[model samples]
Target: MRILLTGGGTGGHTIPIVAVVQELRRQRKDLKLFWLGDDHPEERAAKENNIPFQKIACGKFRRYFSFWNLIDFFKIPAGIFQSFFLILGFKPHVVFSKGGYVSLPVIIAAWLLRKKIIVHESDAVPGLANRIAARLASKVLLGFNAHSAETLSAKSLRGKYIFTGNPVRREILKGDPVKAREFFHLSKEKPAILVMGGSQGARFINDLISRSLSKLSEYQIIHSTGVNNVSVIARSDCRERQSNLISTENHYRFCSYLDVAKMALAYVACDLVISRAGANTLAEIAARGLPSILIPLPSAASDHQFANAKIFEKRGASIVVEQKDLTSRKLVSLITSLLKNPNQLETMSKKAKNTITKGKYFLIKKLRISIFKIN
Candidate 1:
């Protein structure tokens, strides 16, 4: 009947929580929903979704030493206090934490208040935050298979784990190719490739794509360059350069960010996707049965992006191109080769779709059972 959701830091942590919120609302319109997190993209997402949101002070835990670590040490207690007061007042029936530093304080508070807590991890390896949250959580849901989390096996968490393939936004799977083609003013003449750099966008991928525009002339392009990098790539000089390099028959569309509507359309319109291998992004791509070339961020926490990409590659869902080894020429060649073979693309798409868990409705059922048992 009532739910408290928390997660932040990156879209990967926040987006899945949003998907869960959406599903919960669809199933029960009268449900009272509240979000607790830091002042980040999740705040904006909560506002857009009309979920009542309250901010809590949170701190990051870094592996290496930093001057900020000294300051962050104090913030942890402050965050716990903030969470305690907030959770005590809200007193929700259940708290679902999509793992992030922000979720730790919230989960600890929920446990202290004797509320049910469910935590989800989106990586092959659990982060420090999730590992801590798991101790207090009644259930630990995983994006990958349970065996992939070798680090978790040695922990004291005995009965709190289940493998739930990453939750994807249902809206993503509802795009119409005809509507998408018209919406983007794209011709059906050439195969379209969608390039996504996550919510904040990846500078490395953006730069490589900019330089490789000429090489992608055979395909129509739909590029989401993140909100921050859109203007930089949209400047007159950049546009002029892209125009000269791109063939007249090919189309290039650039967007700073894609909302739910545009995102679904882009997914449907594109024949292939080139993206950073964030778990949330891969989940959406897999749900749509799209073949992709994934460029893992070398700097991702715990090198999780590389791990995620490798799994997809092993499953025949995607091609992994490490950022360290990636070049404009290399990316161009891979794209062209993949696109040239329709059968391979189709096979990859089928595998990608198969990777997603069948019967998503079961998650909703499981959540309801958990919540009712708690109530």
Candidate 2:
């Protein structure tokens, strides 16, 4: 079987497709895979999976007025032309699209080429790209619940939309706590905290951690400060100890990025997760039954991250704090209060694992064999 995976512009779009590609490779040895995406960020991730990749122009459609949007209007047709030829040459049997600004043209080109298309929407609400792609897709997968996916389209298209949660890297499930203790040199006396802020524009969370790290000395902290903001860690007395990963000031550590293995260990080692409400990361955390404090990106497209976080909050899986209300003092207080109640944490974990939509891979496998498969 030949499969062309399409999505980009952020790790949220790219990572889920990578997880699906990993499952595809594991299920079949004869499959041919190609990735068509935008931007340089995920090219390394694609190559790491040994899949050939092609970059295409992406024209974002904004809800508000922008002069750049007028200029970007032309890139859509150009991208379609590029994607058309690529899809023709690849002649993929199925097109797997994780929706983002980069994917709309790819979806149109694949539809024109008459390829079977399956799309997954990771946000609680569908953005313009997925809202458009859902109409063209033969099967629409939802990272949230059925009601969430149902609202993405009209009642007529409901048959195509299926709730499959979100795809998580299989390696994320295989963490060893003993290895994590030895490697990170974590103290057993203090509770561990994992802080994440997605791949881009993490300065807000970075600053919060900087202000609050000293106040939360009772806990060990590991902060993933996005690649561009790692320098935020080397302040005051702490200097650069290593390359990507740095150990600083008693019980604190920081890293620019976390590959699958490192992320797995971080999940198990930490008693609590503090993160932005990206659906991909939330899926991984939910899979492990980790309770979290989610600070959603208020400015995200359609304000979908906040919407995603609210679902977790409503389910008793996480505490949602608005960006405007977030501060060092409130953060420290929340962390202290939550960590003090072990029973509440356990209840949160149970709700996280039990309440959210899950087991996406099984349905994904069924799609590959049934609706998506072509001889």
Candidate 3:
């Protein structure tokens, strides 16, 4: 079957698509895959997986009043025009959308051709793009089960709903801690804490880490500070080392972003995760059964990240810290407290593993059976 994957804007959208595609390839080698997006992560995922990628015009809507929204409105029509012909040429059997602003045009074009479209919503509260695409979807696959009507808020969205938990790349689950230590050159004396602001990197989190890194010299910190923020962190890291505030050379390891392999290694190497509460990242963390301190993005649309973090907190798998409440000192204290409480850590780890709502079925198998009608 020919599958055209459409999603982008951030790692949250692109990574899950990669995970789903990875599973599909394992199950069926003959399946032809194509990706459509105009972003580095999307293009890289396609190239890394050897799927053909084509860039397309993409536009987004703002919830709040914005001058950019007026400008973006025009791009949608242009995007639709471009997407229609792209879909016409590819002749895909299905369009799997991971629900990003970039995907609305593709979903519409696929709908125009009478092609089946499947949408996966990775947030507890759906984004506007997904909310619009959900109207046209044949199957609306949810990353989290929708308990409240807020997730599927529109009355007109009549698609079949399936709660197939967010897909985590299989390679992410196959990490080796021994190799991680070697690869990261981590000291065996201290436990490692993985700090990430999600795929794009968070300046907010980076600032917090920068202020706290010297004080956080008690544990190894492996930070993914976003690609754009690397130099900023690098300069700070140098100053900290030069000032001898950080006792060891290997105390802090940082990068702009981590590819799949490096991310897997980081997951296994770290004892705890300090990250943004994006559902895709949370899915991987839960799959790995790692205890975490979740700092939700304060300005997230619909306050979704806060909701996502609360779900983990309710499960005892994570502690939700609103960005407003988070401080460098608070982060250090939380890490210290968790390290001191091994029993709590163990329980949280167990909860994280069983956090999967649809635990019985493999995500790809579910997709095959649901979409392909495979018995």
lDDT of 1 by residue, 1-375 (tens): 888989998788888878888777776777998999998888988998999999988889887999998898788888889989988888788898988888888888888888888888888767789888888888878788754456577457876777777877778778789889887878888899999898778777887887888777778888877755543355444334532222223477786677777898999999999999888898888888899999988878888888889889999999998888888889989999999999999999999987755654554445445544655
Instruction: State, as a TM-score between 0 and 1, how close model 1 is to the true structure.
Output: 0.92
Ranking by TM-score: 2, 1, 3
lDDT of each: 0.81, 0.83, 0.81
What digit string (tens of lDDT, one per residue) describes model 3 on residues 1-375? Answer: 888889988888988887788777777777887888877778887888788999888877888899998998898888889889988888888899998899998999889888899888888888888888888988888777764235686767644788777888888887788889888888776889998888777888888887888787788988877755543556546433421222224588776667778888999999899999999899889988999999999889988898888888998899988888888889889999997788988999899987763342366567656655521
What is the RMSD of candidate 3?
A: 3.6
Off by over 4 Å in 2: 235-243, 357-375
- Worst lDDT 10-window in candidate 2: 234-243
Candidate with maximal TM-score: 2
Stretches of candidate 3 exceeding 4 Å from the true structure: 147-150, 153-159, 231-233, 236-250, 357-361
Each candidate structure's count of clashing pairs: 0, 0, 0
